[model samples]
Every structure is written in structure tokens, then in C-alpha cells.
Target: MSAKNAGSKPNKPADVIETGRLWQRPGFLIRRLNQIHISLFYESCKDFGITPVQYGVLTTLREHPNLDQTSLCAEVGVDRTTMADVLHRLEDRGLVKRKPSPTDGRIKIASITPRGLKVTEDMYEAMREAQIRFLSPLTPQDRATFVRMMLQLVEGNNQYGRTLLKHFD
Candidate 1:
């Protein structure tokens, strides 16, 4: 021991070790990745002024056309309240139109407007670029593996999620 340190106690460890461990935790990493992707999406599609969920809703509406809000909720993997809010926002933006169902007066069927379709199409490249950027750090093979594993995890745990995903044939 050095002369100056002879009477001193050894230094205590930090209250919490800060480094790779937290970053490696699956929940933390997944949450962080989601945040990063959202940032990338916003950056790439800033001009469109639409969120990821909105884009998904618009795309689903474009495909299904005139789907009831409940159906949209299932297709978009969101709760009824969230779907309702999103629909209101899109309708205010004039990107979607909603009308009462003829058979069921209480239900509203939603359809993407021409403007919504155009916006969705225009935002395609940007969204694609954002996805590419998000996976850019991985090699081609690794990217495929990563995506496959992600799908597997999501599928396996789907039942536990708050949102329900509608499976497509």
C-alpha cells in the first residue's frame, strides 16, 4: 500500500453499475429501439405530418375500404379509444371519411379519402428509407434473422399484448 493511502479505507463501489447491462436488457433495448424508430420515422417523413399509427390506419383503410371502427381497431392493433382518437384526427385532416353504417346506425365505417391515399403513397419512400436506416447496422443475413426473431417473439407473446393483431391469410 502507498504511504498516503496506508490509513485510508478502500474506495466503495458505485451505488449502481452503469454500462452495458441495462442496454442489453431485452425490455429496455426493445423500448429504446421503438423510440429510435419513431424518431427516424418522424425525421424521414416530417413533411407528411403523420404518425406511424396514422400511416398504418390509412394504409389499412386504403386496403379494406369502408371498414367499421371496430374492424379498424383489430387491423391496426389498437384499442377502441385509440382508434377513435386516430380516426377523429384523420377526419379533421380530411384524410379519412366516416359515415354511419346502413345496417347498424350506431356504427361508423371509415374509408380513406383520395387525399389520404395520395399521402400514403407519397410517404412510402420516406417510410421505406426509415426502415432501411433502422436496420442499416446489420448485415443482410443478420437483418433477416433479426426480423424473423422479432416476428417470432411478437407472435409468441401476442396473447399478452393489450392490442390484438388481426391475422391475414
Candidate 2:
């Protein structure tokens, strides 16, 4: 199948895409890029001792504090059970605290502790380094263009993204 017409399956042969074939495919390239980015992020962020998902949650909280578990899950693109588990871990580590929301006693509100903010801040440098490492091959001009295109694509297709993305952004 032509790369442009390829469905979810690997390029027809499954074994020979190295000839600049699958390299031109969006879905395949995007997945491969995500893998590279995640690998770089994890390898470079080990000292921060936080997973990528946790980092996303932490940064989102930094931007919008006092969000409830449901909101946090939506913001972080995690399912309820998984969010609950991660929240529990953060709470146990003293990085986050949850209490009954004043507006709704039945609902729990989550917030990053001062320590969590500090830890997140400490990780910022490593995050920048990881991002740079991931895109190191690009020229500065190309990097800017790539980021602009990516943001455009993301914002333009936000409605089609898994979890809608707004809950997190």
C-alpha cells in the first residue's frame, strides 16, 4: 500500500520501510518520535525521580492548582483508577495533598504541596535538556518551524485528540 493510503497496519511489507517509505508516513513517524522523546525524557530525567505522566500531572497542577481528582485525571489524560493510584503515590510522598473541596464536601480537591512545586521546579532544567536532546538534530530555524507546525496541528486537531487535550492543557 502507498504510505498515503496506508491504514493502521505497518507499511505493506512490515519488514522493509527503511527505504524512505514509512519514514514519510505521519502516524508511523509520530509514534516513533514519541518513543524517542519519551526515551530521552526518561533517561535524562532520572534524577528527578518522576515518571513522564507524573511530570505532566505536576506541571498541570503548577499551572492550575487545587483541581479535583476528576479534573486532574482529565487534565493528565489518565483514567480514574490510574489517576487515583498516581495521586495516592504523590500524596504518600508528601508531594500532593487532597482534602474535601469547600464547594463540594463530597469531592476531593488535589493540590501540589510547596515541596512538590519546588521539586517540579528542580526538574525544569532537566526537562529542557531532554527536550533539546530530542530535537538536537534540527537547526534552530527548523526547530522553531517544527514546534510551530506541531502546535498548529495540535491546536487545530484538539477536538480529535484522545481525551480532547483541553482537560490537561
Query: Highest TM-score, which number?
Result: 1
The C-alpha local distance difference test score for the whole of candidate 1 amounts to 0.89
Q: After superposing candidate 2, which stretches have Cα over 4 Å from the reference? A: 1-20, 167-169
Scored against the true structure, residue 7 in model 1 reaches a CA lDDT of: 85
Q: Show pairs that collide, candidate 1.
A: none
For model 2, how does the per-residue alpha-carbon lDDT over 20-104 read when each residue is reduced to its tens digit?
A: 6667567798899999999999898998778888888888889899999888876876777888888888888888899999989
Distance (Å) between predicted and true CA of 75, model 2? 3.6
For 1-169, candidate 1 gives per-residue lDDT tens digits of 3356558774743322234578636778899999999999999999999999999999999989999988898888899999999999999999999999999999999999999999999999999999999999999999999999998887788777777777733
What lDDT would each prediction earn against the true structure? 0.89, 0.83
User: Which runs in model 1 stand beyond 4 Å of their true positions?
Assistant: 1-20
Q: Could you tell me which residue pairs clash in candidate 2?
A: 75-167, 75-168
